[model samples]
Target chain A: MRRLSPPPTSKLVIFVVIAFFLLWWVPFSHVLPEGFPLRFGTYRTFQGSMIAMWAIVALGLNILTGYNGQISLGHSAFVAIGGYTAAILMVDYGWPFWTTIIIGGLIAGGIGFLIGVPALRLTGPYLAIATLGLALATPQILKKYDGLTHGTQGINVRPEVPASPDFIEDWFGIKLSNDEWIYFLALFIALLMLVLALNIVRSRVGRAFVAIRDSEIAAQAMGISVPRYKIIAFGISAFYGGIAGGTYAQVVGYVSPESFNFLLSINFLTTIVVGGLASILGSVLGATGLIVVPELPGIVSFIPGAGLPDELSWAFYGAALILVMIFAPYGLAGLFHRLVRVGPARVAGVLTPVQGAWLSWRERRRAPPASPGQTGAGSEDRSSGDQPGTE
Target chain B: MEEFWQQVVTGIATGSVYGLLALAIVLIYRSTSVLNFAQGEMAMLTTFVAWSILQWGEYWVMFPLVLVIAAGMGAFIERVIIRPVEGAPVLNIIIVTLGMFAILNNVATWRWGGIPKGFPAPPEIEVTGIRFMGEGALDIGPTVVSYHDLTILVFAVAIMVALYVFFQYTPLGLAMRATAQNPVASRLMGIRVGRMLTVGWALSATVGAVAGLLIAPLILLQPPMMMGVLLFAFAAAVLGGLDSPVGAVVGGLIIGVSENLVGTYTPKEWLGPDMKLTVTLLIIVVVLLIRPTGIFGRRAMRRV
Candidate 1:
């Protein structure tokens, strides 16, 4: 019998090394002609940046909904707050772009903490309803505070232009445009966020979050302050939303109440669901879906006899969500994980006849008499158990 | 004082519409335990049906026919789309409804252009002002009520009374209540729980259609016109309690009055005209904080 062991950690190390090389070299140096149309590098950079922004938000949402088992429908409100705050700071207060970005995040996180104080007492639909109200109200509030937010007219932002005298003639060796710079900045933030999120998921705090998500009562009995943890999750999630909003504002170069509508919140949540709720990589996938899918209807309009209205994009998303819930409940990330696990296990011949027999006997022993009530209870319990680490 | 009274009357008229929509929402919630986000869009579609009917006949004559069609469409939707997800997770159900929201909105837009369409008012009520305090000429006198406003108030009250009678006295209503309380028990009692649920949807659609028709004359009919009304309806539903029909009506009146009063009296610098949505949201948040189940809702006990 040939025994199979897990692949060595060195394999991961090598993969990362090669991945980084490709990420850096392929876009800028190796993969393109001198004058490629539309500049694939710039496009990739922007795409990467947008993905990073979404990943950050997804990580935050994961901590709250996935890790803490709290449902919030007002996340886009936080994003709007963050974006508007950054814009105001940069335009009105004469704050540097970076400073405004950080401040925006902190402000949003603080507001999240306040909201969470009241929200922690509520659960399920009650929480969801409260957040829904918030999402609906934020745009109105923005409109009311027109002096601050510029109301329906919206605020326009100028990209940060590098001030270098030596390279003024040759653009100071800055090959990348302002849009490219913003993209790279967003990407860097995303990478940092990804690393932090991964580390947190592996840490004690992450474990506590998972425990709480699995069973708040159980976690509480085991000495976790469930309310405190829930608030922390809210704060963390808001923090990510804030940064993402700021990044979005910078990239779009415009901020409006319409930009952060309740629809955006739904879209973000859908992204997380479609990308796989628990997986970090799923966030990236979800972001990609969010950005790319909306463009499909528009792109298809160019084809003869294939024109679709812009609103069809939303319908497509709705259909996609339904299909995903019905068939791929675990999402793309879950599917990948299952494939990874099952493929290796099957390849390694892990399941022998004796093992199969043992497993079948175990399954039989575990199976309870099937009833509608029992099935409902069983699924509920399974969901409850799976709630932790969902983000 | 005159302006205040005018605002109050206007608020009440608007509140009646919100209350009607809220009642529809409550009916659905009570029967299904699902918040129908597409309620406004559904109502809009049904109202459009009513409008199409009006194109061929008189307004009052078309009303009943529109209601029947709306009810049938509602029941059809419940059977086709909502029934399958009865056993799904709450989030999944929510997503489906959101999908419906998108689909219905787009469908309406596709059918009817984005331009607002005028809805003809019934000839029985005109826009003439009625003297409340003998045509008061005082500097600080109450505002005169318009005949149109009175008509709306009367119609709203009549609908509520009819609904109360139907729910309190009818067999179908009892079946619906039973299904809402416990579907399994209702099924065991041979109550046709699925049919009751479908009826609930049908009734809700009918009520929502009426609401849309009432409001259509005041604000021209458009694809997105229902969005703001839906928000107010949500606030009313939450305020009254998600499950109680009476609560929805009362909550709508309160929200309507308070919104108007606030708009009239609030400091110009603090809250502008747009603050109505913000205020409604604040009320919802505050109410949830104080009582998550709502004013009239009984606390639900979850089995672990």
Candidate 2:
């Protein structure tokens, strides 16, 4: 039997070191000399901040959809709540930015809990539609109550967005631009949330989530309060969404009803699935990919004599999404893990067993045919204990 | 009282269009268990095809051709894009449909440009010299309804009846129904399950195309025109029941009527016309709270 374990310690250390270096370098890379090859633009820093904000929501969504097997097309509402909370606190009540993030998170989590109680009855597509209702209603609710949300015109927080403290300039000998400062702020919060997500997925609470997802009855039999854990999952996920929402306000310095539309929720679901569901790293990778993939045409156009029209950018994005789903069903992180495990030489052997596992698992749940018993038995042997389906 | 009746009449006309699209969505969901988010986009694309055909051909001539083309496109998509990920996780299939949505919408915008085109309704058909559909309104008791809205309602009813007949009486429909109920059993019984699925897509696309054709004249033809209707239709499908065809149509009618009524009758201060959509969706959520499987959906039995 093959035992799955982390990569060798030396390789892990190198990976961590490189990741840390990139995170540390991104905010300051804009400061590099104009002609330097390593120099990145202020725009890239801003994009990085957006990616960080998006990743926070992706992390929360993955916990619900990926780990807990609860699909939410309504996360935009939670994010909106968090964002509005932050914006209202900062702009209306004169609250500091950092404290507002926590408040936003708490408020969002509370509402998530309320939604979850009702959601306990729904499963699969039904649950998905129920949450989708939340997403659909968010903008209307935001617009109808102009007194609170500032209506369709949206709220601007640019003046309230905090500038970098003078201590940073004195201590680090680096004077950061507004975009760079925002990027660092978002990145720091993302890192903190990422660590918390990692811990949550590894702890006892996380195990309950996975078990409940696998089989609710089985989880209940194992003394896991299914509803409690499921609701808790929603709360935690919404808290993360709220935190990201607060981060969005800090980063974008604006909030509007239109910003939290249905498409945003759909994109969040796409991010987790495309990133690799049930993965912390996949969430980050997906958020980065979501931001970067649309820019691919622009990036490719830089090549001499090779260009894709800007109008076709969305078409290209759609094609990329399809190709990725067909070829790399487990997502970019899954592809990355597979490469790391097998190395480049054995890459061709990637699709067989895992795909077989999913197919056979589905078949087994349906009425098993007696004719293909041999192949079915063979497939079941490899997939019995470790299927990745949400059955 | 007159205004209330008028809203109801108008609501039924619009709701029928919603029902038509929702019926298409339900058709795919029932047969393949995959919610085609791209259903509206598929319809929109076929309507564009119809618009192009109309440039040279007559209205009646373009109609059947567009349906055939739409059916073929649906089957082609099922075979090429959907086949590979057939047995994967549900989320994977959903994402693929969304991908298709993006692709179709973008391609249509790219091909046709974003300008809203004037797509004529099924041109004034003079059946028995009575003028069935044309640029005129008919008074029925307390309310006057436009010929286009009446045409939409008629098309919707005709399609529903045809579908009911197909599913109940035809051999091909039986095989498709069997395939939907139990693919493994249907395969063991020598039904070509794959062929049935392809046919299902073809049938669903035909229904959706009818919806697009009927609605384009009301909302004008554009790439993004179906975005709002698609959401409403999705809500309609869920409201009626994902698997029940009748439920989808009934759900659509209910939503349509309630939306209009809510807009007209609700208190104007905080929850009036602007809040109608929110109220309608809230009603759906409330209904779902009572019936998780939808109003007409069968409760799925689990063997835990």
Candidate 3:
């Protein structure tokens, strides 16, 4: 049977580019005249930037947890490192914002390398617990070392945050607000990192990371240096985390001990898992879902008789999480793939009866009835395991 | 010198609480290999139920009822939330638990509100005219231990021994152990593998309830009350070796004592009480560095 092949890579790239541009445009579009279509609030633009920033962290975390099979509950520590570094360099030493972000990433990556050496001795839940210890201690360490961290009050980076450059005003005939400027900066960084992640996962080093994740002894036999690649994965992942943290500093315009708490680390892990592990698309989807899903109740409240209390929002998020795990175990990415594979008509069969009937009637008329053997094969594929494709 | 002894004693009391929760963690990990991140929240929810029950009933009377409710909740969760993804990767199950963590914490906060409420400890009892458990301090050697602290210690040891006997001498316990060791073989041997797992969860939830009940009196009942304890308990469980109950308790004791000692003995200018948690965690990390499987955990062997 002939399989419907995926869209050409060039087409996929163009699609992504268009989608990303729209993501940037829609939120910032609120600056348009009152009657403009799809215009959103500045707050939405800020939220969109947050999504971009979180996606960067998710991409980094997926490299370690999804690709390399090392669980870390201490990523918040790395983020804190990056955030504090940027905050300190900008506030105290008066460094340029861009340079500080890069330096923050580099420092975080260096520390990640040091931590990864010890991490090599651990695996599975043990490694998770050890790293959790790091997360649990980070706040206290930050608070205690007030000389660097600015203690509990936290450092405000609002004054240090960069405004939109004059070049954009001259060239595009548009003046960007600070929020809009920051959003663009974050989106640019996120896109660059996303491209980097895509390449890294396809490279020889990425193969080694995957090989080791599948089996350490086998990877070793295959001539992959297990410790070295694991450490490198840690460094790369931390660098991404640091970059995201720096972005976070700019987006939120503050750096505090409480800002990079253990819950944030746990959320990062949750983002990757729910987005679809090991898939670059999954990371971005997960980040978007993490930021946007919680606000869904508020968004839906505009609908008549559909209002939900804000108190129940977290409970809704929790239920959504569990449902996602139960129904779409490979996360949103896997669900997307499944939908693409099975087509709308087949999916409709699982929906409401009236809709299913209408769709099936249309489907039957539009195309010949599928061969018996082909449909059977498709159902079998649906029942297969939850492991997301490494690609 | 007296201060050192006092810190050690105080540490033991708090450590007992950590150990109790860690024991609950180990029971589930032993059977299902899932680290229940929601353990503390489960306990917290039950303790809240106990608080609500106490409004209409006595403390001891509410205790057993709360345990039963906790057990039922545990079984329901395992069957409903956990059973479908039972064979998924460890990370997926952990995520499920994290989801449960959010749900339980949110529900408890929404239902009870976030205010700290006074939870009563087990009241003083007379066993053969010897007073046990009351509101007072007992002078022991160099330390003055609170009655509540002693009560926690007593309850911790009792639960440990009871669990030991239950797992050692009982046929059901043996079956559960068999299930943990090799579920397929246990199934072939006519053991109800699924039932054993459900029971393991029930047992764990019950143990967790006891920990929550005991700790609540000291810390005051609140939604986020158990978050800190849960982290320490996780540390204890990992430190003790996830599969070993005894290890959990010992690890808790070690962590508790060291935490207190570090806070008390460290320099006031730089590494005093404020830095105690950081220091303790550093020490735990160092220990983990030396023994990756933890001090008591058996090294896992896998075939390629």
Candidate with top DockQ is: 3
DockQ of each: 0.47, 0.75, 0.76
RMSD of each candidate relative to the true structure: 6.8, 5.2, 3.2
Q: List the residue pairs that clash in candidate 3.
A: none
Off by over 4 Å in 2: A1-28, A348-391
Q: Rank the candidates by lDDT, best first.
A: 3, 2, 1
Chain B TM-score in each of the candidates: 0.91, 0.98, 0.97
Residue pairs with backbone overlap in model 2: none
B145 in model 3: Cα distance from truth in Å? 1.6
**TM-score, predicted candidate 1 vs. hidden true structure:** 0.82
B226-274 per-residue lDDT for model 1 (tens digits): 8888878987888888887877887788888888887778777777566
Better of 1 and 2 by lDDT: 2
The DockQ-based CAPRI class assigned to model 1 is: acceptable
What residue runs in model 3 are displaced by over 4 Å at the alpha carbon? Answer: A1-14, A17-21, A35-38, A348-378, A383-386
Q: Write the per-residue lDDT of candidate 2 for residues A6-69, one digit (tens) a residue.
A: 4223335235424853674664475777788756677777788888899999999999999999
